[model samples]
Target chain A: MSTIGYKDWNVDLADVGAIYPFQGWEVAMTIVGVIFWLGWHIFQVKRESAHLEKAKQLGDHDKVHQTLERY
Target chain B: MEGNLNALTTVFTEFYYWVTVVFMFLIHVGFCMYEVAASRSRNHMHTLMKNVMIIPLVTVTFFFFGWWIYWAFPMFPFFGGLDLEAGAANLPWAETMGTNSSDRITGVFWAAFLLFSWTAASIVSGAVIERIRSSALWVHAVLIGSVFWIIDAAWGWHYGGWMVKYLGYHDAYASGVIHAIAGGYALGVIMVLGPRIGKFAPDGTPRDIPPHNPWLLAIGIFLIYTGFWGFYAACNVPIIAPEVIGGQITGITWTATNIYLAPTTLSAITFNFLMSLSGGLMAAYLVSKGDAFWTFSGGLAGIITASAGNDLYHPIQAMLVGAVGVVIVYKLHFWVEKKFKLDDAVGAVAVHGYSGVVGLIIAGFLLWGAPSSPFEGYATITPWGQAVGAVIMFFVLGFLPGWGVSKLQSKLGVLRIPEEVELQGLDYAEHHAYEDAKAEIIEADKAHLAARAT
Candidate 1:
């Protein structure tokens, strides 16, 4: 069976709409999309904070001053 | 012009393709900038010239015979003989090929395809930069642009193509037809062309060669993304009625169809495109740990990965497909680089070739049993069909011809520049001349100032 519900294009064009797969799962897909978005924020924030913490520990006074001067 | 409605439709269709052609020019501009930025200052002019020259070379060669091959070779040598009757109308000398009152669509349609040829050639140009001879690279450009890629298009991308009829090949936006073939061709060339000097260490560990100008490279990729929007549009027949298509589709409702005469919507592709790009970016950032180059290239890889089924995929599916493809491609790039010791300057093989192959196989499973064409008797989309189509695209048509040609060139001692030239850079002579000119002009200005003082 076609994943998109219709196996062929033998039907009338006026009768057709929304040929994407899993026709009745729009709500479920939206939920998944939301989860992905939320998950990304969580992951990114954690990584960024960890990275910043490491940077703060590693930065020396002279290098920071040199960087400021260069800028 | 015919009736008012017919005339309007014809003019609208012509303008649609014309606009897409104009937008697709940015892809070439982006390629030139990207190639130049990736190369060192000593090679900037040569790198830019190498990519910029692809336009006229592919353009002329495409005009000469490339367009005809698309119509004629859809089933050549295996399924049927050359469709010479259809081919005659597209020949360079044909009346419709030039300015013709009745043929409003020919020029714009030809141009849309010609731009794709340039892109295919430009992709190969990027991988072989800094070392390949201009003459050798141009020869490869013409072959890939006007010869090999078009042949794959005829087999897989054309409406009546055997791959669609028999294998159910469904690359709506040409993940395989354009990207895979070009990437595979680049791989073939680089294997023979060898790595740029200093690209490897004594122990054969690959060294990263940073871009000379990351900012230019970033802007270049962004321009490529913009041009890709036009590319998606160009792959479609903007509007057509069932009667004109003469397929199984009944009723008078006009709709846009992909190159294979399958129904889809511009709105559908739009939703999938953005979602896929986002998915690719997020995944790439995590996978490459926010490396600027891979992250930018990942966005492109994501689009290519989902493009095979973008016309039919749900937006969510597109995103996930793009994300999944990027991770796999990223891993494969490093693994292959280590194992094979082959240098691909821009990761063309991973972003385009591997993503394309993955997209096609994924489309097979996702779109399985879906009609590949609107016409009756066509095979349904299947995983095996897609897998086989990927082989034909990446290996038979793409890699073989590329390797064969490059090997022949290498045997003739003209495939790459001399070792001295490679060390000094391809633009060494030009840079010296430029410096000399600047010195001369400065001395002339000094002399003029002295005379004024006197």
Candidate 2:
């Protein structure tokens, strides 16, 4: 009934393999990880787009000139 | 000093821990950078020095009595008397504590624990910056670093600890023993120390005291992440035979074991660590609406949240636990700030303390009916046992002593710098000699330039 498939640490080490919990769900976990990775790109793209749009709206010619000169 | 196999294993284990100790030093460097970045320019020197001094102070005091406390206080005053047999070998004057060819392991092992001691004290250091007196904070450092946290380690993290034996207290990576207790200790000190002068509006709304240098802050946290990888490695027994464990484990096979000597794998913790870090980063970005600092800190919070069961968790389970803990800790940080008008300068209480308590209770349910140790006659992991263990860590050992000592310091007028000093800055106030010397040197340079011109 243990999630990791062993109820205790009594097994011989030579016989044990893949001691992580839910040992048989490698594909499912991979799928979840992939989804998470893709989702991050989507979130970052949307957030950055919105941010750049707002920055574009705040265009002040004198301030822009001052920023360039400072740099 | 023995057969080839035994000698090889001993030297290998010694080298492994020595590397982790070197890696863990980066954690302190990160703390210094993070704290200095969080503070204003006026408080920069003070903040850096405050954390930098923790190294020598904690290292010396830990040598004097802290190592002995870990071996001596595992069951003291509760289940049994002092463990003098265990304590004898760890005393400051013990031959093994010094350079000895017969014992290659003690130095590296003591250093590993000593680094953890610095972290516990440094966690407190961040929360009370700018306003606390150096003398006061140093006293708190020695207590938390050399006295309190080690006691909790003996009770929970040690292989034969009483909490592990009776309460099924399973903090595989010190979610409770180090993070929770240090967070609670920070909370206690700040309750009396109060906020930096301008941290609140007169109307009682909270004001954000953003870090002066976000780049340094980011770099600091990144270094901490790097050091944390070594911390995870240090928490395990690199290799051990079943016979060496002498528990219920059978056969001649060797394996890696957790601090409590229960079987685990380095591969398993590695999977959980990266997954949990990712989960935290994503959740923090979403919850904090892409605030850079919180996003970085979220990754750390995520790992702390999952660290309790990282050794045993499915990678996916670790990810979700970390994500959930980040959201809760983020919300709680602001809620406690506004409601109580208490300023935790760097959010230490929520990130470390609250996350630790949350992680411990969650582990109780997730790891229920599981064995807490390989040794026989120990209680199995259960919700009630973990809940009680969390209480002992957060409130009993951590908060009470911190608050009591701070209150005494406050009464003696030694806990905080004066109001005038607070406004002018601790650097200018306490280290006037350096400022005076700088002014004198500049004047002399100006006089030399005038004479040359003439």
lDDT of 1 by residue, B1-454 (tens): 8899899999999999999999999999998988898999889989998888899999999999999999899999799999999999999999989989988998899999999999999999999989999999999999999999999999999989999999999999989999999989999999999999999998999999999899999999999998998999999999998888999998789999999988999998899888899899988988898899999999999999999999999999999899999999999999999889999999988999999999999999999989999999999999999999999999898888889999999999999999999899889999899999999999999999999999
- What fraction of the true interface contacts does model 2 reproduce? 0.49
Total backbone collisions for each predicted model: 0, 0
lDDT of 2 by residue, B1-454 (tens): 7899999999999999999999999999999999999999889998999899999999999999999999999898799999999999999999999999999998899999999999999999999999999899999999999999999999999988999999988999888999999999999999999989989999989998899999999999999988988999999999999998999898898889899999888998898899889899899998898998889989999999998888888888889889889999999999999998889999899889988999999888888877889988888787798899999999998999889999999999999999998899878864688888899999999999999999
User: How many angstroms is the interface RMSD of candidate 2?
Assistant: 2.0
Candidate 2 residue spans exceeding 4 A from truth: A25-55, A59-70, B430-435, B449-454
Q: Per candidate, chain B TM-score?
A: 0.99, 0.97
Indicate the docking level reached by candidate 1: medium
Where is the poorest 10-residue window by lDDT in model 1 chain B? B281-290
